[model samples]
Target: SCHPECNGICAQNMDSTSCTDPQTQYCSPYEYNSTSQSCNFEPTCVDNCDLCYNTIECQDCSPGYYLTPSKLCSETCPTGYYPNGEVCEKCHSDCSECTGPSDSDCTACVDPKRTPVSGICECSEGYFENSGV
Candidate 1:
């Protein structure tokens, strides 16, 4: 019997159910358990992780955290980090997103009220910006 929630096809085994596509690795909010050889229904991600597989291994992270190339979730990225499609990246101090590490390399401001000024962004007149908001 195949799983009802599986997006792709699922193969039913005498011991358990497994997803046929290895590349997709999807099982409708669940992962195939090789240990018991079944589809795991319980959640088992580390702190700050929203989706997990292989027990403690994270497939997706909570907000403010990003999934790394190594499959770990981190609040910040390693040096020389660049965007890799919803992956972790370190932006310039004054930028939400940037082309380079320098403050003047900012491509966008973190705050909507602020405008880019000489590579950095600051609040326009009559507006104030604060950090760690």
Candidate 2:
């Protein structure tokens, strides 16, 4: 038997008998409760998730978040940060952004004290360009 509104039921006429398809039904994000028989959404995934199968298991993430290799949604891994498997890590002290963990790997510098000369940041005016320092 389906609900009175028939919102979650698909009725098919065959040989004078009506058949209801259970798989055709869909539930909203807030109404996906596994224990409930009705098409209702339950809060299963982590916070800021657009879609998830259960608590702590995210299928899709909301905006400003990135889906990691482990399937977890993270907001910390922005443009200048690196994923250290669990969280976003800061690059070198001289770098505003970097490809690795060294000063030579810097993509850009914080400026004034250090300026980006090529791909790396060098000491600007009033400071000597020291290498291997």
Candidate 3:
């Protein structure tokens, strides 16, 4: 039976046997409860229960990444930073790829004394187009 109509009972006529609200009432796009014994509303589950940037809910990790229950969904580490303890981490500004903590995964084009923009080595001495250290 429809809600508030048959008082939640289906009559022998295959109808609510009483007044029941028809599905056309609200015109919902889709109802998870179509064949429901009674007229009750239900909710649908979405992926991952949580959402993250650059990541799809209930999905696998991208390359160079791993999945962990403690991790935020679809979370990504910035370039040069590796995944560590549910976050991305990088080595020293000088070393590449975990040579040591605080060391960079790749050497800087310019010294740390200079300002940085876009991870491209810029001139502290004031120059550009740096190939490597």
Best by TM-score: 1
All candidates: TM-score: 0.40, 0.37, 0.23
lDDT for each candidate structure: 0.62, 0.58, 0.37
TM-score pick, better of 2 and 3 = 2
lDDT (Cα, tens digit) per residue for candidate 1, span 45-121: 66777876445566788888877766678876654354555585666767876766677766678777887787687
Q: What RMSD does model 3 have?
A: 14.8
- Candidate ordering by TM-score (highest first): 1, 2, 3
Of 2 and 3, the candidate ahead on lDDT is 2
Candidate 3 clash figure, as a count:
12
Candidate with best lDDT: 1
How many clashes would you count in candidate 2?
A: 8
Superposition error at 133 for model 1 (Å): 52
Model 1 TM-score relative to the real fold: 0.40
Q: Which residue runs does candidate 2 get wrong by more than 4 Å?
A: 1-24, 28-35, 78-133
